[model samples]
Target: MGEKGECSGVKPSDDEIWAKLVPSDSRYSDVEIRSDEKVICSEISAAFGDKHSWCKIIRNSDLCSATVENKSPNTILVDGTEVHNENTVVIKDGSEIIPGPDKGGFVSYRFDILSSPETSQRQLQICVDVENAKCSICLNIWHDVVTVAPCLHNFCNGCFSEWLRRSQEKRSSVLCPQCRGVVQFVGKNHFLRTIAEDMLKADSSLRRSDEEVALLDTYSSVRSNLVIGSGKKNCRKRAHTPVDDQSDGTYLQCPQCVHEVGGFHCNNNTVHLQCQACGGMMPSRLGFNIPQYCSGCDRSFCGAYWHALGVTGSGPYPICSQDTLKPISEHSISRIPLLAHENNVHEQNITDSCIRQMGKTLQDVVSEWIVKLNNKEIDVTRLALNHVETINARTSVCCDCYQKLVSFLLYWFRISIPKYRLPPEASAREDCWYGYACRTQHHSEEHARKRNHVCRPTRGSNM
Candidate 1:
């Protein structure tokens, strides 16, 4: 008997006796095991045929643990293992117990420790690599991590928002700064933001200067998930025709002036949405299933709606081509996008050289990867695009987004190459310490040529 219990030599404090047995059979009540005495399996003896002592629970030195000795003449089982008569087995919280050998007619009970031990109050430790918490764009701990769809890459909210603004201004489509995937959606990731914040709190040195943070905050416009638009321009050539007299010089002629389209005719009373692609106007029909607005960006485009109505570009009415906004499957890529590999020209040249060495065109490699992407063979965890799971060959995307997708696929193409398969000169080079995030590759031609940038960063900082 324990010091506190008559059955064991070890003794637990008065308050430490919290172990008990919870019977599986509702007819039997719970059996409390005290440190001062051992618990005999008498409460559930009716199910076991007799009230004979089948088992005895003796308290151990640890308040949360106890030892169960089989007292029944027949064998019993504790947590699936056989415990013969006189054999004692250690029991902890949630340990299952059954009497009379295999579970045929005997009721089972769970040994539960009602109170947690003092050691359980200690703080927990978790391992998280700081490198993963840094933003690829700013090369620092994320200020407010934002995750982009399709690619699902993370970045600082201010950094990505600024990138989004610049990409939108420079082109109709917004490309991810990290993977160059056309960003269909972007929003602040509360989970990653917490991790980033925790990392910064752990190491203050990773934090950016107050001034830099303030500036970045000012540039952040993304408060929630934003759907980006492909800035497709209307490229259809207008035919020579007379302008409508009712049309003020400010508005282009509506298609309804010629004839009814899709069983609906436009009138002066009908509200109209101006086309962002071409300077044209189309009647806004909210009830119609026809898509007058680009899904990528909520902006209105007369191309799909007009095309659905069998209307073509004329002198009086300007309609965009179907190519302006279509499904991602219809989009094609011929050349390498300049935005590939974080816009590193050296890496781009190396990739181009490698492609030529393999006797493959950029288009061939892109098409092959697209097949892999559609087959779900590729891991898109690192790809920085919105609605990544929804992206496939048939997914609707703008021409710019398609280019961005091609660029992202090309990256996987370059990185997946075996060293021996690379050009001899390229194969001889080693990987940069900072990998794709290497800043030196942008400025130092010798360094860029000597080291590869397609790999992940070995160190969190250039230092």
Candidate 2:
């Protein structure tokens, strides 16, 4: 009876046993885990025992991590414990595994973690067509391609400049070559030029000779940005071009290029910025005491531009909405954005209630913080905006950019205050397990804000 009971003892399958075997110590540091299905260490295999199957690893769905299993009978140890044949041990990120017994010869493999799918996949070269990159007028790969609006046709700078010169000489209006509509605006398409160059580099046969390129360079008129004048269809009168405005040449000129604007006329060398929002041109007047360009993106916005000139969009050109750009002092926010607190709605709600309980408005809190920011009372060493070194309350920014700054500042404000100082309702909550890394933060706002998310594991956590 005893012998039968010993022989009939249940033996677990390798898959079943490995399924339940999780790593005793799941925290591994100083090791790199690979993405491959199996990474066998040849050095360890050669030094300790057989050259194959000494140590094997696979994705363990149960643990959501890689697991190391012993395939040989000789000896294997994970950390300091011995793992016999068919016995499995889960491997944590940055953990080390030994292929042989600790007494004699052994080889160690460090398991590393791959953070994202982008990092796991290898990059490949992108192919482009040379024929599609050619200019319609020149019938060749574009040499500094310029885009003409309204018709939305593309042409080489040299070819379009020559055509414009001829049209100005013979007709009252400059028209698009393909479609005879009066050209309203034209500018060099930097993006298309880059593609054309790449196509040429890929196929040298498509490149033009040096003499041809040099000749084209001479005819290139689309320099900086050009603001075309309005051509009257019924009136057969030639409009006098702006002073120093030569045909087929590039120069910066606002509406003042042709007429006086705000008692100022644009000259041949006037530096201008193209409004990113409206595509309108404005003189770069740093002395005008108005914000024309966004310090964050360095792009021009027309809101402050038009306001400073005491004019609106009723003129020939367009004007952007005033709400797009304004002085920081003029900006106001009544409700916190849904994106605050890493899009943790519960947390945002708590933050809101906490403010309300204190008898303060959102704007009031932000105003006080902004004053702190300008006074250099808070360290902006980690500001996440572009040109962080130059950005401050005095720097005018776009609406979207201003929101980002406010969000960052609010984060510092929330994390700096003592937990005990928080309203009683917020002070009693426990921190979440994942904290900032919680995946539920995006889907469940309540879970994100209900718990504290900024604590690390306490020592002896496993014990």
Candidate 3:
């Protein structure tokens, strides 16, 4: 007989064991079941000491009950029932097991479960209405769901993307399809996308055909979170001046409206784009050589266009400074961006601390990594930007997009560093099971500080 192990104050995670075997006698040590399948023998070791292969204990998928299988010819009785060789019997909490057919001169153990599977597993369940997950535009379960800000309305990326294209062509302002509120931002809602997928899986009848999904994918243009505009109408507003015979208050005007610039003038049919920064208007130059829209976010900015035409901010026709939008090579960062590490302040602090410990400035580190990005040495698959493949040092992006780029680059920089090269405190911490995909890191400070989130997730779909 073996001695029973006392229960410890700390509990194991779901992946670990929640039960143990307490021996009736004090001679043998209690066996702690750590894995899904464990074998018990005379060796009395906690981890796989079953050299004789007496019997095997298999944890059921439910994580509460377990089954005991007789491996050896020895008589094994599970709760007074004989478990023949190659046979098994179900065992629950407080179930007694005797190695011999009888209790005499045989070791008997009690299976004690410390915690239930439901209690050990750390999971947050959100009950979402299935109908609410459907896209308003397509009237189906959202395929590639995207969320628009201000109204917080959601739609299929393809449906909204096509809608956005048509809206930009006709009007300067893009409104939510479901709500009339002005759209200030739009982004792929990964969380909602998962929910939509789960819903489709639950009911296959709700799923669209393969051909329809392919067609919708072709129209989908949104790749990352987009800053739509400054929430102001992009339409050109008539200057508040004395109404002349040539002027009509009904029609809006841009810089090209009054006089021709760049050998071109805005006609009544000319499409316009509102600047996300200054709310100024510019003719939508689709095939023209001038860069009017940011390649990173697809948002229009008047800085580069106005600078190319040598226009400056004036009165009602305000223009942004050239610094507002520029090539990636021209952008610089003095400190770490808030959007870095998925806005996990703890991870950001760790990265900032690591950079300082390395005796390098944020700008210096960013410049070095940017070179790698331009040289095509770094993978941009994780970069949340539109036209990501076409982006390089020469690509024009807004200040917000520039920050996103810097954050992406910083991620690579942090991950590239060897563990030994990290600060002593940071290097000592263990990697988080969920890595950067960890939702707990955002809410739990102690968990965030104790685990490294820069690495890849060891488990879950994010892996």
Best by TM-score: 3
Which 10 successive residues of model 2 have the least lDDT summed?
A: 1-10
- Write one digit per residue (lDDT tens) for candidate 3, span 1-463: 3312332322434564456775666354557776677766564344654445567787787666889988768778899899888899999877888876678766688786545335444334567787888888879999988898768899999999898888767775677889777776677788888888977887899999999999999998665455443223334366544212123222245688667888988664444666778776776765677778788877778888888887777645768888878998898888899989877887788789889988999988988988888789999989999888888888989899999999999899999889988878789887865688766556545556767988888755566
The list of candidate 1 runs beyond 4 A from truth reads 1-253, 256-259, 267-273, 283-300, 381-384, 461-463
lDDT of each candidate versus the true structure: 0.68, 0.62, 0.74
Q: Which ten residues in a row have the lowest lDDT in candidate 1?
A: 1-10
Candidate topping lDDT:
3
Q: Which stretches of candidate 2 lie over 4 Å from their true place?
A: 1-254, 267-272, 284-289, 421-426, 432-440, 444-450, 454-463
Q: By TM-score, how accurate is candidate 3?
A: 0.54
Please write out the lDDT profile of model 2 over residues 1-463, one tens digit for every residue.
0000000112323321111111112221112223334434332222454234555677655344676777756577786788888788877654556666673444344443433433322233456676677777889999989998778788899999898767756766678987777776677787888778877877899989999999998887555455554433223247744333334333333566667778887554344556778776676564577777666655568778777777687766557877778766677888887666666666676677767867899888888888888777877754556667766667788887778777766666677768886778678876654454444345433444556643332211111
Order of models, best lDDT first: 3, 1, 2
Which structure is stronger by TM-score: 2 or 3?
3
